[model samples]
Target: MAASVDSPTPAASLNQEESTTGSTPFLRNGTVMSRSVKISSIPDPSLGTDERVGESDRAKRMKEDSLLLLRGFDSIAQNLSQLSSNLGSALQGARYLAEPPTLREIFHSRIENSESRQEEVEKEKIEGGKNTGLKRKFDPDERSEDQGNDFLNENEQCLEDKKLKKAKNLAVSMATKAAALARELKSIKSDLCFMQERCALLEEENRRIRDGFGEGTRLEEDDLMRLQMEALLAEKSRLGNENANLKRENQCLHQLVEYHQITTQDLSASYEQVITCLDFSSPTSSMMEEADNEDD
Candidate 1:
């Protein structure tokens, strides 16, 4: 009974050492010595391995989403670059379509002269007798029977022929100008239609980009860009119409120049004919006529 009571104390001590060290305490030779030592590490008991793995997976997902967002931003930037380039090109094209500064100055001068000539044309049309202005002022006392009536009639016929030829040339020039203006108008219309289609395509692409991104602010900005594009298209159309009208006005001015040219030639030719007739008259006859007038 004494040995049995003492045996329980050593066994209890062995069990205590095993519980504290997390290993069995082995007996060696005559004394018991620890074969392995356990070093305790600090760890939060609440954060289990499973919970840590879940957090890691969530972090990975967040990283992936961030990367995706970055890519989306990059794509948006590329789209913006393309849009900016397109707008620049469109503006450049518009600039090219506009008249040059030098040409504009020329057009201004032409227009001023055209307006004045138009007034003259209106007067000519209203008078219905352009010959009245062309006819040279002459005195009946200067008339002579010696100047054959046949010669005077012949001069009149020649003048009529020259007038007819000038009229034909002016008509031909007007027809040619009208044809050119028509062609220019057609080209402008075609260009406008092409630009309209291009704008429509851009708008559709913008809508798709907006829908894909699903960003409210970006969508609104795109909408504003679309509105600006529409306004630009409207302005371009207005300018095209204005240009066409200006072309027509220019054509009218060109016709006026032709008319003036023909009229000038006709006046010069008549003046030459009149001077020739005066030169052919006798000087003695003119002196006698002067003496007779003085006696009266």
Candidate 2:
């Protein structure tokens, strides 16, 4: 800004000097215009202390306004950075809430399988019980062999005894197979009962975990909502404060405008004096006045 303010002096000086349309003031050793004479040295036809003071004050106020606007931009940037960080943190917590139902389903399925096995065993036991009942009904016929004296022929008696022995062996084999099957069925029932209990416990635990997760989710949402509300309120406050600051700046500008209006009257008087001298002296003075009027 200082460089720009200072750079204009050389151009103004060239305009005042002898008319040389192509006189480009070369800066150091090459291309750019570097050093320039100060504006005070260029002879304006009319000047005063009060106009000088007004110009200086306007420049100072403008510089201060630029500084304030820069600071406001920095504050806005910092707020945006903080908001981004908070959103990132919220995303991480959401990923951890998805695991208990899978374990519960697996446990329940195992329990169902165990119960089905038990049912199959009970069905086999019922079939074996019916066979055992038929064997019991024929048990009395085997006892008739005790009256062996009626058969006096040894061959007939020996053949009858052999047939009885074969029947007895078959009954014993069938009983052994039935007893083994019953024992297996008993074991399977116990295993099913145990699995049912375990699965029930696991399901209860799953419910608790789900409840806990729900509570956590509600808490997080509540916390997030509260945080968001607070952020909104804070933003409102910041905006309000900024608006107040802007209002103050606007007030300052209004006051500055009023001050400039007062100064403009004095400058106008000085300007009228300068115009009188310019009209008698230079042809381009009309153009300069037009340009200056446009700038104003």
Candidate 3:
């Protein structure tokens, strides 16, 4: 009776064990599904060949465009630096020119201030003398004074001519420089406008590529690599967990199978014992019948 009672316990345990192990395949299915999702998320080299080509070309074009823009900007910056220096020098020159007392004016004013009236005063003093000899001597002094005045006038005229020439040359050079500067500035402005438009287009293209695009589109190269690494790590962790679960389920199945084997062995031994008793009882009954017959 104890054996009978204990016998159902193993069977019941087996039933519970079977029920528990029956859910493992669902876990395997989940693992398979997760693996398949990972596979599907991977880029297919076969189908994405054209896309890869397009991406390479796009990257190349963008790199070239950016390089060109950078070069243009560098040149523009250099030109601007030079232009600023030139403008500063030009401003100083203009300020100097705009102020009073230019070299020519100073030279002329000094010449005028240095003019001598001493010859005329000496003439007047000599003419006021009563001696005829003094008058005769003063006549040559007047002629000498006139010749000195003519020489001063000639010197002034030469300085004026030289100054006028210098002024004209300076004015011509300044006009040329100003015109060239204006042209250069216009060119810079146009280039800047072109660069601005180019930058706008690049920004728009970048936005189009980044916004709402799949998988790695919105991510930088480093971010995408990091994300892929994280995904791989997560997958590795999940697979480890699944393997652990499988090991646990295998252990449970092994234990259940061991119990079933033990139960089968016990049942077989009991069957053999019952069969021997039946065989012995049959022979004993036959013998008793023979004895009874003989006695009668």
TM-score-based ranking, best first? 1, 3, 2
Q: Which regions in candidate 1 have their CA more than 4 angstroms from the true location?
A: 1-147, 209-214, 217-296
* Candidate 1 C-alpha lDDT tens digits along 1-296: 55544456788998885666564234332133223222234455677887989999999999999999999999999999999999999999999879465433454565567558657865864474344334323434434542466367657756765665565455455556666766777897787788778778777876777686665456587777778678767877887788778777877777786766666565546656657756677989999999999999
Per-residue alpha-carbon lDDT of candidate 2 for residues 194-272, written as tens digits (9 for 90 to 100): 7556556655755665677756756665565566556556755765675577557556555654654454344424434
Ranking of all candidate structures by their lDDT, best first: 1, 3, 2
For candidate 3, the lDDT comes to 0.64
In candidate 2, stretches whose alpha carbon ends up further than 4 angstroms from where it belongs are 1-152, 213-296
- What TM-score quantifies how close candidate 1 is to the native fold? 0.30
Clashing pairs in 2: none
lDDT of 3 at 208: 56
Q: What's the TM-score of each model vs. the native?
A: 0.30, 0.20, 0.26
Window of ten residues with lowest summed lDDT in model 3 = 263-272
